[model samples]
Target: MSGAVQAKGGSRHGDPNRLGHGEVPASERGPASKRIVVSYGFWIFLLSDFVMFSGFFAAYAVLVGNTAGGPSGRELFDLPLVAAETAFLLLSSFSCGMAGIAAAARNAFWFQVAMAVTALLGAAFLALELYEFVHLIGEGAGPDRSAFLSAFFALVGCHGLHVVLGLLWLTTMMAQVWAKGFREDILRRITCSALFWHALDIIWVALFTIVYLLGSGAGA
Candidate 1:
């Protein structure tokens, strides 16, 4: 009887030192269980965000020719400036990638530096973009003056808003890293941020090509 009791106890508490025994596989865990809600949520947010851009593209398609005797893309768009903006955004994306690599390696200092660099680049892009908008508006080419300008402002401004939001997110994540160290949750958040930043870069490339290159051709 004593031996049977001991045997049962051993089976019931087998390997008390074992971690996550008889639990769900890591990959099979739900988003909540794995603390991946932010990762999954960010992707959904991106998709919904893209829908807004799609609407803007449709509007631009309809209003591309409505120059209203002010100025068209060929007259207003400085391709070199737009190209510089593209390069800044692209570099930011690259920095974000480096941040992810640092996060994965658990190097907190390098990760923060990379994130800071990305934020600076994003800020520079926003500055250039706002300057272009202000310059255009100053020259009697405000959005309200023409359907084409209105569509252009709406599309581009929305993208700029996203960049601003992304910068805020990056700032928050940096703080989180500083407070919590490079835990798995923080690393996942950083990874999601990287994905989001890169997505913006890709969207900007498309926007640059369609709004700048194609618009210039149409105006010419």
Candidate 2:
């Protein structure tokens, strides 16, 4: 009878939620460790990227009015073109989120479709930005034209470069999904991609508001 009571007490003490001496909860053990580590590391990377962007934002804010007698943002910025670029990027982020959902559900067809749409939207955004840059340079308002132009190019071009990199990353993820299916590793990569794409949309929104809208005298 005493042994039976002791066994019952031990069982209760070993409850999955109960962490005794040197015991780990099931929620924090095994495969969960890998997922937690990967996500935490990725978040650190994103935070570092944000810090870099902060420096660019500060530089642009300081130099925006130093146009050296060249055409100002009010004269050069095309609101309609910028609005289109913003739309494409924002929509791509939505589709990328859908792709992540499809990946989690292991729906290969929907995942591929959503990813394809996202890639196309991202490409369209890059194309529009390239056109804007070409038009500016053709008008002799290139980065070398003035301090304001230099800061504008540095900020916007940095973002454009990131978009190009994101497109490449998206293409790689598609290839990985096609080859590996919705395995754990593939899903993790998809999650990271979703986070990255959404972060870019947020940054672009800030850029649009501060650099484009305000610079164009919309808020002035």
Candidate 3:
């Protein structure tokens, strides 16, 4: 009887069903570690991307005046169109934020919808940008015609490439969510992509201000 009692006592003291001392349950581990890893990885990527943009910016600063006495920023830039493009991109960032909120809430349907809306807004912004480029080129202002035009095209085109790549990344994330049903990995990737997209939008705002606004007044 004493042995059986001791066994019972041991079971209570060393309960297999209980959490071990100073141990965390898997569910309670939280996403902090994952967030840190992801944030670090994204920062590295952003740094690399910024390096590429810096090269383009330097090239533009050097060649912005080789306009061959042709149209310059003041003559080419339509402030109204640029303003509209900025609005679309800013709104797209807002939509991406909404999608992130939905993902955090585990609301799959709303997350998909928000992502779709963000993509549409991004597409609209791209369309406007492409139209601006084409219009400039059509007026004998092609990049090959002048160093100024080449630099302008290269800087703006590189930015547009990023936008296009971001849209592709966004689309892939949406598809992954549909296939995986909000798995932790998918959510993390989506969060990273959202950060990247929003960062691009912010960078574009600065570029637009510098290239179109300040540069427009350079030779005036």
Candidate 4:
């Protein structure tokens, strides 16, 4: 009779959340881990960006030849200048990877250094792009000049705008890291930024190939 009561008490008073001495039931546990939540949600955001860019790509493709008798990409694009810009952006991506590694190791100094390098390279790429735009506008190849130019500016300019936003984000992340060490949330933020920067790098590479190299070949 005593054993039966003790068993009954154990059943009633023991961890009600557990299942046969196993881990607690997931339903009773808290929300999903922050890593899964952040990464998964951010991937959705990136996919939406990809969709937007894909639309721009399609528009550019259709309108590429519809220059309204104006200059084509081959005549206007400076491959040398674009190659330099590509180098800077590619280097920035490498630096961003280094920064991510530093963040994982929780090395504040290296993280800052890598992030600074990334910012500098990204800025250089942006500066070059701005210069190219200014030169093109001065040459009367502005977006208003032709449908082709308009599409060109829209596609390339959109990417430049992203880079500008990324720079701002990078600055903010640096400030956060300085104010607070490599906290979990901050590291997640850094990871997202790195992903964003890498995405830009990839888009730029495609831009270089299609809009620069191929376009230049066509006009030549």
Indicate which candidate wins on TM-score: 2
How do the residues 1-220 of candidate 4 rate in per-residue lDDT, one tens digit apiece?
9999998878767867655644556677789898999999999999999889888889999999988888898899899999999999999999999999999999999999999999999999999999999999999889999888998999999999999999899889999999999998998999999999999998999988989999999945
List TM-scores for all candidates, in order. 0.83, 0.88, 0.82, 0.87
Give the C-alpha miss distance for residue 189 in model 4, angstroms: 0.4
Q: Write the per-residue lDDT of candidate 3 for residues 10-49, one digit (tens) a residue.
A: 8667866765533566778776687688889889999999
Looking at candidate 3, what is the lDDT of residue 118?
96
Candidate 4 colliding pairs = none
Off by over 4 Å in 2: 1-32, 218-220
Model 3: CA > 4 A from native: 1-35
Residue pair clashes in candidate 2: none
Using TM-score as the yardstick, the better of models 1 and 3 is 1
lDDT per model vs. reference: 0.88, 0.91, 0.89, 0.92
Q: What is the lDDT of residue 51 in candidate 4?
A: 89
